[model samples]
Target: MGKLYVVGIGPGGFEHMTFKAKKAIEESDVIVGYTKYIDFIEPLIKDKEVLSTGMKSEVERAEKALELAKDKVVSIISTGDAGIYGMAGLILELKKDEEVEVIPGITASSSAASILGSPLMHDNCNISLSDLMTPYDLIKKRVELATQGDFIISLYNPRSHGRPHYLKECIDIIKKYRKGDTPIGVVKNALRDGQEVTLTTLENFDDTIVDMFSIVIIGNSGSYIKDGMFITPRGYKL
Candidate 1:
């Protein structure tokens, strides 16, 4: 029996990658993933046979990874935790008779949160605004409900050239419950090259600076900024 490893390589940088994820990728006979994500791990994957696929080719990538795993150790790598909008689910769905293992890595939200301070110290929810596979209405409802619950939101895929206005729309819904001064942290390329982190208020957020590579963290009512760090109090009596 061959092993199929689904590994989350973390946010763009090798330093963010977990030991287990690195081991799995190193041990695998073949690696498969999106071209951009593969480019992030080029240093680690040197001398290893890799199969790269372009955008919207996830199905093909998953199928190929499973097929390759039938006889040898194959790895499907993703940025951030593989289960979170990664290739793990699709590969598993297409997998049959293969021993599969999912190695979790430091997700972008958590990583970006670390850079911005402790904004996720309390209850929080993650939402992706891609709407490629998920519907836009559903994404809006999630944004509305997350805001109503006062949950610190870690927004993934919040903006893209194709759906530029969706993030602004989501922000408008959040304003219905949160104050205009609510702290918002925007991180781009997270720990990767040219990374940038900014602490701003929802009212003054610059949508023009965000892209598909950015991760946005919107703090809840209890959230505040101190010494340029965004903090969401865990409600511990001081």
Candidate 2:
């Protein structure tokens, strides 16, 4: 029987990739992932056969990986924690009669949040602004609730070419339940070269920098900053 390894490469740096992930890729006969992610790990692949796809073809990619895994050892690479909006979901959705193993990696949100201090230490939720599969209204409702409940938010897919204004819309929704002065931090290409980190307020988020590789963190009501890092303690007093 063949085995499938769902590996997380971690935010986009060689150092961030775990030892196990490297070994798995080296041992695997085939590697599959998005083009950008594949490029990030190309040097490690050597002569291994690689199958890369463009954006939004996750289901197809997962299916193809599973098909290949039926006959050979396959590794499907995910950028961050495989469970966090990664290829894990789509792989499980299409997997059947196969032995699959998920190897976890540092999620971008956690990595970015750590760099900005503990903005995610307390009650928090993650939201992806991309409306590719989820509806806008649902995202808006979640944003409203998250804002009202004073939960820290780790936003993924904040900006892309097709959805240029989605992040701004999300910011507007957050502002409705929170103050304009709420702290927000944007971390792009965390752990990778040319990484950029921006600290701003909810009101000024639109004027700041953003990109597809960025993770935007919106602090809660009691969140604060120290030494240029945003922090939201886990309310142990409450």
Candidate 3:
């Protein structure tokens, strides 16, 4: 049997990608991933056999990667950290009992947090608003629970063309538990090209501007915006 390496390319930026992730992609005989994600690693896999599929074909990508790994070293790339809402879980679930290595990279939450200052300095939880696989009811419950717990919430897949109203619904749920003035940071394409960061409040949030590429970070009660930075205090008394 050959080897399989699932790699996280880190928000489509070479600087954000881990050394091991780059190495795995460099050494692999075949690279497989989503079409956009494959484009991110284009320079590295120019000479290798690349296989890619469009949206909602994750299972097909994972199975193809496993099939290619039977006799060749295959590296399946996922944006951000592969284990967190990435392809790592699916790949491992299908390839159970086989050897696979997951190489980590900077996730969108951490990358966006860094760009927006220290919004994640305190306790935080990540919730994706996408209901492609997870039901909308469950996603809403998670958002409500995370808000009630006062955890800094990082929302992935916050809005899309199909589910334009989901983010607004989630923000409404958070407003019930937290103040309307709670800080909300929106980062699009994080460290990649055409990056945009907007700092607003729960009351002022405009979900129309958010898309699948954006990450929305909601701050806790203690969080504040100072000098254009979103900060969640970690009890560091001055």
Candidate 4:
């Protein structure tokens, strides 16, 4: 059996991709991933056979990658850190007799945090607002718990054309526990082309600005804005 590399390209850009991720892809003979994600690493994967599937075809992509890996080195590409909202878990779950290796990449939360100046400097947890897999009540409960715990939160897949109100519903839950002035940072297409950054408060946030490509950071009570930077202090008194 050959090696199966589950790789994360990190926003599908060279700048955010880790050295190991690039090296793994270069070493692999075949690349498999979602169609849009495949386009991101097109420049690095020259001369290699590529297999692509559409939005809801994650299982098919994993199966194809595994089948190819049996006789050749196959790298399955993911956008963010493969384990977090990536294909790593699914690949692992479906693997029966394959040598699998997962390569991590920069996540949107980290990159967006950097762009918006350190909103994740302290305790934080990441939650995806899309309720395709999980129920909305459960997602709402998690958001409420995160708010009550006062942890800085990174929200992934906040909105889509079909579920435009999920993010707003979550914000309403947060507002019940958090003050209206709590800091919220949003970054769309983080580190990729036409990237956008907006630093706003919870009450003033414009939900129309976010999409599936956006990363939303909601600050705890300790978070504050200074010098046009959104910061969540690390609980250090200096």
Superposing all C-alpha atoms, what RMSD in Å does each candidate have to the true structure?
A: 0.9, 1.7, 1.0, 0.8
Residues 66-100 of candidate 1 have per-residue lDDT tens digits of 88888889889999999988888897888878889
Please give me the total number of clashing residue pairs in predicted model 1.
0
The reply for model 3, stretches above 4 Å from the true place, is none
State which candidate has the highest lDDT. Answer: 3
**Global CA lDDT computed for model 4:** 0.92
TM-score of each: 0.98, 0.94, 0.98, 0.98
Residue pairs with clashing backbones, model 4: none
Task: Give residue 70's error in model 1 in angstroms.
Answer: 0.7
Model 1 RMSD vs true structure = 0.9
Tell me how many clashing residue pairs each candidate has.
0, 0, 0, 0
CA lDDT of each candidate?
Answer: 0.91, 0.87, 0.92, 0.92
Residue range 1-238, candidate 3, lDDT tens digits: 7789999899897888888999999989999999999999899999999999998899999998898898899999999999999999999889955569999988999999999999999999999998988999999999999888999999999998888999999899998999888999999999999999999998888998899989999999999999999999999889
lDDT of 2 at 125: 92
Ten residues in sequence with the least summed lDDT for candidate 1:
87-96
lDDT by residue for model 4 (1-238), tens: 5899999888878988899999999998999999899999899887999998999899888988998889899999999899999999999999989999999988989989989998998899999998878998899999999999998999999999999999998998899888888999999999999899999999998999999999999999989899999988897879
Q: Please estimate how well model 1 matches the true structure, expressed as its whole-model Cα lDDT.
A: 0.91
Error of 2 at 166 (Å): 1.9
